[model samples]
Target: MEIKEYFHDSCVYFLNLEHRDDVLKKMSENVQEQSLVKASFGRAILDREKEFPTGLDTDHIGVALPHTDKEHVITPFIAVGVLEHPVSFQLMGGGNVEIEVDIVFMLGVTDPSAQVEVLQQLMEMIQNEELSNKLESAQTKGEVISSLQHFTSLMS
Candidate 1:
């Protein structure tokens, strides 16, 4: 699938939240406001993160991929959050180890089978240091979207 289709300008954010829960809550609320997810999405994503962490330590920066089940998703989306300050999150493998994350990609996936493909695409994009750096330094929502679109076009 072309992952760029999942990005929306309204879903991009520059967050200054201090805590992980707060960051997820803000992104969840934004997607919910856009009608991308149900009201339960916020709580569901928070609970899921507690059970299964999504933090990744990339070669260039720390990233988090927090998502909930399809039941909470109204429509598919990938919400991007560039934190002003890094926030701590548990590692993906049920480790007690924590990593400070600078970026968050909160995914809303309605199709269960597509989750894997979407993740694979995201992984590819995340591995590109230039894209990650561009995302980190992006000054506006449009810039963020443009960067993602540019990267995803390369994948296509």
Candidate 2:
């Protein structure tokens, strides 16, 4: 599946939140408003994060890929959050290790098997320093979407 298809303009956000939970809650609410996920999505995602942290300490910046199981998703979507200030999140698979995250990609995938592929693509994208810089410095949602689309196009 094309990963870029999951991105929606309405799902892109410029957030100035102070904490990880707050950021997740806000992004989850937005996707819920768009009817992409069920109401249980927010709680499920939060719980999942606690169990399996998604924070990545990338080469260029700190990023987080928070997602839940397929059951909470009504439709697959990727919600991007560009934070004005860094929010601390527990490192992925690094117990008690925390990283300050600058960008967040909240994924809602309905297909269980496809989740791994989507995550792999996202992992590749996040590793690109240029794209990470563009996303972090993006002045508007359009810029963020444009960067992601361009990157995904190259992958195709």
Candidate 3:
């Protein structure tokens, strides 16, 4: 499925100023409003942070995905959070250093099997330096939606 099909334009956060806990909390709140994710989404984000951290420090840009198990998800959807102000998230690969992430692709995978495809597509998009830079600087909902659509189509 296309990222646009799963991530509606309405769900894109164009002016997110909060960082850390507030960011994650707001994301959880957003999903909680819909049937996509329940209260457990918050728990999962925190739990995932402790286990497999999603922060990425790439040559072009930095990004993060606070993903969780399917059990915490209700409906499948992605929360494309564009932080107007960068947030600090611990890097996953190694090092104790944290990166300032302007973009967050929070995955709500209701089906466990869908996680692999979603991650693979997301990774492909992340690997594109130009695309990653564009996404990092995206300031409008339409821009974010179009970028996600383009990346997903390319991957597919």
Best by lDDT: 2
The residue-by-residue lDDT of candidate 1 on 14-106, one tens digit each, is 999999999999999889888899899999999999999999998899999999899999889999999998999998995888999999999
The lDDT for every candidate, in the order shown, is 0.93, 0.95, 0.79
Kindly list the per-residue Cα lDDT of model 3 for residues 31-144, writing each as its tens digit.
888767878789779777867778887787778888888888888888888887788888886667788877888888877777898787777788899787787788788887
What's model 2's TM-score? 0.98
Number of the top-ranking candidate, with TM-score as the measure: 2
Listed in order, each prediction's TM-score against the native is 0.98, 0.98, 0.89
- Per-residue lDDT over 1-156 for candidate 2, one digit per residue giving the tens place of the 0 to 100 score: 589999978899999999999999999999998889999999999999999999999977999999999999998989999999999999999999999999999999989899999999999999999999999999998999999999999999
Task: Write out the backbone clash pairs for model 2.
Answer: none
Tell me the lDDT of model 2 at 48. Answer: 95
In model 3, the runs with Cα more than 4 Å from the true position are 2-4
The RMSD (Cα, Å) of candidate 1 is: 0.8
**True-structure Cα RMSD, model 3:** 1.7
lDDT of 3 at 27: 80
Candidate 1 overall lDDT versus native:
0.93
